[model samples]
Target: MNTLEQLRAGALSGARRLTLRADLRELPEEVYTLADSLEELDLSGNALDDLPADLPRLHRLRVIFCSNNRFARLPEVLGRCKSLEMVGFKANHISDVPAAALPPRLRWLILTDNRIEALPDELGRRARLQKVALAGNRLTALPATMAGCERLELLRISANQFEGLPDWLLTLPRLTWLAHGGNPFSAAQEAEALDNAPMPRVNWADLQVQALLGEGASGHIHRAARADGTAVALKVFKGEVTSDGLPGTELAACLQAGAHPHLIPATGRLSGHPGGADGLLMPLIPPRFRTLAGPPSLASCTRDVYDPALQMAPGAALRLATGMADALAHLHARALTHGDFYAHNMLHDGDGEGRLGDFGAASFLASVPPQQAARLKALDVRALGCLLEELGPRCAQHADAVQVLADACLAAAVDTRPAAHDVAQRLRRLALPCG
Candidate 1:
């Protein structure tokens, strides 16, 4: 019963961004009539099968979220919105996504949890496209033209029918994040085999346990050195730490997959320790823990490490920060989130380089609630901010670098925070700024 004039006035007077998911079953005529001035719109979690045809008239619109709907076809009007950059149609009934249907300037397109069988060649040819989330679909193959998307960084196609990943996708110059594990079209056989793989045997006597590196409510970390003189950090997890077995497994998997130069890669697992405890063996970081002075406080070790002044050259600080950023980006690209990202968990190799050391809290986006996942990201951002603050006056010398770090740490909201890849890019730029 709402009038167009009333709706238009309400939209104009109210918030420029409108979310009309509640108390609405169908697209009200008044809603579309007021679209001209709208900059952002979210109609997700609704029962609509199709969008209002007049959506293209919203020349100023930038973001549109229609996920969790009943739409079976691509919205034809989207191509007309010149200003449109982000479109989220996840959890919809969409089966086909016409390449030409998307706007040229579209930067983010999320079609996860849909019926999409394949993407149009032109979809990947768009130069401005940066992120695409198409997980939980039926895609058997990716368009070859996707190679043309020079700026694309994230491509998530998990839970699909792929037998093998597209070679081109693996070779993407800018594509850093890729998650296609669950797809039958990719390496399903390998992944399945890994799930049932036997655990490696461990000889406790052969491994010399050094000083206690860290401790948590659920586990304790010790610096262990093998007889061969190979040193590694051993994270011994108490059996009763978490009721959920999947998170623990995922944490181990992510660390194992990550072998970056600056990342504390997981070497293998260690089970059947004293008291029937389980643990993981990772590369031993340098003895000098730059983030902390002596040992961490009970509170700090239980949570995360936060140290401000370790006193290092400006170049060393820059290298450490940049390396950490790169490692985080690598994890993010894999659609994995380090739920516990803090200074204590990060270890500096003493050569001005750093590595992400803990994976006990890592998880995949599809496995965790979006809201909860967002909170984890927010925590990481807060930690990043705290780390910058701890850097103190040294940060002032590199104002531009510090600004980028600050922005990543102090974004208005979790969703607004820069992606790990973007954070790494900003760090790289700030590392070498013009006078």
Candidate 2:
């Protein structure tokens, strides 16, 4: 946090990044002194409604964050920042985004937890756009022009007012992660699933909370035990508008997932949190298990990062890939899309055995036409391809077969990618290592 006094005194004259969170109502003119060097700025938790048109004077600015503010409209001057690539306005009162408010060089845009109902057509014109977050808004429909955003990958339109899914969204070649729960279409599908197969319910008081295991954008997972002294992993959702979608949507997907050998099954649903939050009781993962890789960092916006020294035998690599493909095939069979399919979401025991988890970005398939649903399945194939690409180089055995499978999975033509079930079968046919 850069103090206002330091800024005014020119102590931060040539700073490359500046963060001001002193409930600022306006930016001091002195900030302009660093125009030549400033590249990132964070003005979150402030009271600003607009920005100075001269903001463009910061010729090298590339990222800006103004979350938790009082802005009712996106600052139009932002579009004038020629080098801006990332913009975030989370948890604001923004209700309008002018046609010219988007930066041409934008790659990542986050407007989570806002009051916006629509987006400007100009959004589609940015050829470099990739990641987008519009969850927890009042949107009724998406701009048709967004069909041109061919480079778009991750998208979150959950907790909105949409009555149907659009066809163009299904055809985007690079779209991997998509969350659309809390909308009318999704709500109806969830209701039907609950009516057919409800999850077992467990009261909160019956579980003894122990230590926290991990936390994510959606909720916290804890190591807990039942009143009967049975150990379990408990996930207590934040029960709010997460960047991906609503916690309720994730819970619904969990119930519908049923059981699979490579999936962390939900044994029961949590009924009571003192604060009335949604939660799940899952089988306890082994203490020896750990994440295979880390989630993408801001620098590697859409790719997972792994340890460079990590290596695997051909058989071990094949085993891991087979399990993931089988799990994904199961999800698609149940009309569910594991939107956020990445290595970081998998927990491994170091012997090529692991389970897929995290449904925060999952989407429940409903009334889409068969053709479109098949294309959506192909998108998941691409995600699996990406994971295989990461693992192939490290394997010494069956490298040729793994390369062939990866090539087919990543084919540009959606129809060219093999179905997950077929890939799993092929993997199973490969020779296994001796015990």
Candidate 3:
């Protein structure tokens, strides 16, 4: 939130990061003064449709955010910045991505809530690309060349116009977290889940909403109490498109998830909001429980950010891993994929248990062909492998077995990866030594 006055007065001189949101129509010339040191620039909520042609002067810039702006296309100058790796232009009017707009070293790109109908073929040229957020767009097809991006891991293609998924997309060796809900091909499956589960509906009038627990792109969660004197957590979904897809799609997935020891059970669906907002009612997570880690940051892109001081006892880590494995296996068995399977999506009960939550990115797998469903399951195995690898160093006793499983899960050959059920069974067998 550094202001133009601060820049003009040189008060923010040598600053490594800068964010401006004063309805800027153009980037002030003074901003270039700190080019020698600036590495991150956030110019969201502005009216600017283009960047300074000389933006490449910021030689150290590695990340830039221009969300909520008037840009109709991705700025071409960004491609000239050699150090740039992450770019965000969410909530803009961007309808085109020029071939020269992609930087060579690009690793993560966010174009959510835009009008992008197609992508440049050059996207596949970036070997380091790992995460891409293209949800809520107008994409009918993806560039065939993207299959060359072997390092890609996380992708959000939900809420788009694709008639079907690209076949090459399923073969990416490193892809794990993938969300394709809200597409034409997925609509039937989503509707089927809702029809089959038929979650009990709890009218909003029967509940007393309390303090807000947390909020994200899709909705606000609140501590609530039922008229029958039952305490619950109510998630009032924001009736808008999320980075992944529609909220109703998420609710259907949650309903279909049913009950698993390691899953956050949905007690009922929120019905009859005065304003017609949809919601879900579930058991309140115990106060002692907390998210295992923070969601991915700009720098981490697709990886969860753990507390540097956080360490889990081997028993605790094993317990948490086994719980997540069981939850995921149950999900896949139901022909569902918890598209966002990061540790951040799991809640850790201080003792040893972990509960998988957040169906915002979940998608149905039953509709896909049998072979592709198996491939999708293998993709999720890679996600579990990534999670285990992240929690491995924290384990004290069963570190070897955890590492072995993680490595196998991350095998370059997707078919070589173990199934979620197999991994869960193996994890259950490891009798971790008590502290």
Candidate 4:
């Protein structure tokens, strides 16, 4: 949290990265002093509405975060930064993104919670692009030119006005994760899911948070006790759009997913926060469980990183795969897609007792045409295939059946992958492992 005072005092002279959260409305002149050394600059949570031409003078800058501001336009000066590759302007009022503002080296872009009605055609010209977070925008359709983003992998277009997903999106060659809930097409279906759910809704004041359990891109989880003294894990959502989508939509998906033995036991959402913040209540995860793998780093981009020394036996791997497959099938039955399905969203007891959680990136599939729905579900199959592929090296030898099934799940032709129900059934019929 470097301050203007610290920068002016020359205390941060050699810093490579800088972050300032002191209600700045404009760029500080002192910031240019370290342009030669700065690679990242974070001025998020400020009152800024615009950027200065001098901002581009930070020639070595590779990343910039100006979220939670009042900007109505993306500064054109950004287009001049030679080294800039990652840009985040989350929660801003930005409605205009000039084609000239995007750097050629750009790989990641986040514009969640903005008023963007349309994206420039040049967006597709950035062939190096990989991750794009465009949730909560006004976009009715993506520029057709984006079909050329062959290197693209993860995308979040949730809470937008798209009536149908672009057909070319499924053929992007590398797209794996997608979140598209809370849009006009899915509004009625999402409403139906919420209304039909038998989830218990509790008043906010009835709960008392005891300790923080964890936090994610969208919310904070805590260990809490209800008015009746029942122990529960509470997830209080941040009141804004996230890299995934809206918090309310996530809460609804969690409620609609209902119960599955292989899924975290969620009770449902609670109402009546003093500030009207939405929250989800669930049976506390047991201490024996832990996340299966670490989240992706900047270099790995979208792939989860696992422990290099970790190992698994064939039987254990089979058990884990079966459990996850069952959970997916359960969600499939509910017409929901766990778009963010990954090792980072999984928990295990290290003995094959695993649970699938996190609906922040989940979406409803009932609103799309059957062809689109098939594509959505097939995307999940690819995710499952990725999970199974990770299980391969963990064992002394790849289970032939698992490997073959993985190959089928990962069929380059999106529609060729088997459905989740069939995958689960097949996993059950596999012979007992040698271990």
Against the reference, the lDDT scores of all candidates come to: 0.62, 0.87, 0.89, 0.86
User: Where does candidate 4 stray beyond 4 Å?
Assistant: 203-208, 226-229, 268-278, 307-315, 399-407, 425-431
Ranking by lDDT: 3, 2, 4, 1
Candidate 1 per-residue lDDT over residues 348-410, each given as its tens digit: 744456766555445454443455445444445544554555443454467566765765665
Model 1 vs truth, CA RMSD? 13.7
Give the lowest summed-lDDT range of ten residues in model 2: 426-435
In the range 1-435, model 2's lDDT, one tens digit per residue, is 899999988899889999998988887788899999999999999999889989999999999999999999999999999999999999999999997899989999999999999999899899998999999999999888999998988888989898877888877878777777888877877777656666888999999999998898889999999989999999999978889888878888888899998998999889878999889999999877788899986678788999887655446777888899999999999998888889999988777788999988777776456787788788888899888888776556667888888888888777779999998888777635511
The order of the candidates by TM-score, greatest first, is: 3, 2, 4, 1
- lDDT value for candidate 3? 0.89
Best lDDT among the predictions, by candidate number: 3
* Model 3, position 304: C-alpha lDDT score: 92
TM-score against native, each model: 0.53, 0.94, 0.97, 0.90
Among the numbered candidates, top TM-score falls to 3
lDDT of 2: 0.87
State the weakest 10-residue window (summed lDDT) of model 4: 392-401
lDDT of 4 by residue, 179-273 (tens): 99888888887778667778778888788889999999889999999988999999999967788988777877887888999998678677898
Model 3 agreement with the true structure over 134-161: per-residue lDDT tens digits:
9999999888899999999999998998
lDDT of 2 at 94: 92
Q: Which residue pairs in candidate 3 collide?
A: none
